[model samples]
Target: MDVMEWTGQVYADTPIVSAETYVEAPPARVWELVSDIHLMPELSSELREVAWLDGLTSPGTGHRFAGRSAHDALGSWETISTIVDCEAPRRFTWAVGDPGHPSSVWSFLLQAQGEGTVLEQWAQMGPGPSGLSLAIEAMPDKEQKIVFVRLREFETGMKANLAAIKGLAERRA
Candidate 1:
């Protein structure tokens, strides 16, 4: 029997779901796709809306944006995220400031892979009340299940986003 010890702590405050995809585009092009955060909604179908609280410029640490995301019945919700780190054509990370949030950070890391770019999506939340706060305080177990469901949904959405970006970049190339 292969016993696996799953001692990793539960991270409710900084829960992260991550996925990666390789796109047949140069790093520079990939940067153009990600660096222009405001254009996210235009480039990716999953991003319902992205309002730059600041102008269109390469985001810096502390830069903020209000965003809404939802592709189906789940409906869209507003979130304010602050860029904690930004490194062009390589890495960008942000943290959400929504009330009763489950995750604290979301990030994108890009790298040159052969004649293409590899894009990685990562999220982090702290350990507290599952990602859901007030409404589900009465039922912790249910909230746990909901968190799992949301993570899975987010994973699927991220794949779609990457595909959309790949399509746009390839078309331009």
Candidate 2:
């Protein structure tokens, strides 16, 4: 949203939302923000709360977590997520719902650039069961519209998250 153009990808009918910004902090500084599962609710509006499961103290592949979210239109719900990828100081990714066939895939990619980290937040909705899938099924004729609205919501939220992380990382740095 800052200087990056609007970007998205599609995978088998699922819409992907991705946005990146330059954070005035080193990769390690930025990674501390991105890798902390418990910090999300503090930085997000829709994400009301989160917690790690299985007594995990840090993120790695196969770690599980739960998140609770709310929206004026969507109301409130809780989700189960699994860490699908974790590459320190560079990339982190996770899957919502069933890990084997996730309802959504979300990721953060960090690249060191000119003393700072270019942090990107990404999300892809549904190749399996999801609230979006349920909504689409309920209104098959409005699939495109549904996807558009949902992706827009994600885009806006991700941008806000990036901005907050940038501020925090820069302040701490």
Candidate 3:
């Protein structure tokens, strides 16, 4: 995993982090893993649970879902996310909070690589209010540090997610 350069970004900067891995399985198999919202808690350290909303059973553009997440310092919270992009066997993206001004955005991108697939997990922090924003408000002096640390945590989690997906896809292939 390549370290993301987010040294001094503030919350308004909307810092982004991403990690990628090559999976021995094809894009279709990788898509099955990435598109399954319920499987995320199994792979992510922060996410505790997820459920599709409004009777939806699968992912699609404009679909919504609720996710519960927990962090040691931040405790736990729930966010309703909207699917902003959905391209089967290619990409899946969702925005946490309001889609027009999301607190965060996350994505999984798949590209065919030889006989396998290259999968990348990407995330961008707030342009909207979030738990981190509350922390920043409490200690304005540490805004940069807070953002940097959170981005680091996102990077670490994204790497783990990609690794887990790779393992699962290969084993099932």
Winning candidate number (lDDT): 3
Best by TM-score: 3
lDDT value, candidate 3, whole model: 0.94
Q: Mind giving the per-residue lDDT tens digits that candidate 1 earns over 142-172?
A: 7666556656666666776677778877777
Which candidate do you rate higher for TM-score, 2 or 3? 3
- lDDT of all the models against the reference? 0.67, 0.86, 0.94
> What TM-score against the true fold does each predicted structure earn?
0.76, 0.91, 0.97
For every candidate structure, what is the RMSD over all alpha carbons to the true structure, in angstroms?
4.9, 2.5, 0.9
lDDT of 3 by residue, 1-173 (tens): 77877579899989888889999999999999999999999998999999999999999999999999999999999999999999999999999999999999999999999999989999999899999999999999999999999999999999989989999999999
lDDT, candidate 2, 37-151, per-residue tens: 8889987778888898999889999999999999786688899999999999998999999988888999999999999999999998878787666677788877777777788
Candidate 1 deviant stretches above 4 angstroms: 1-13, 42-47, 54-56, 69-76, 98-102, 126-131
**Pairs that collide, model 3:** none
Q: What stretches of model 2 exceed 4 Å from their correct place?
A: 2-12
Residue-level lDDT for 129 in candidate 2: 80
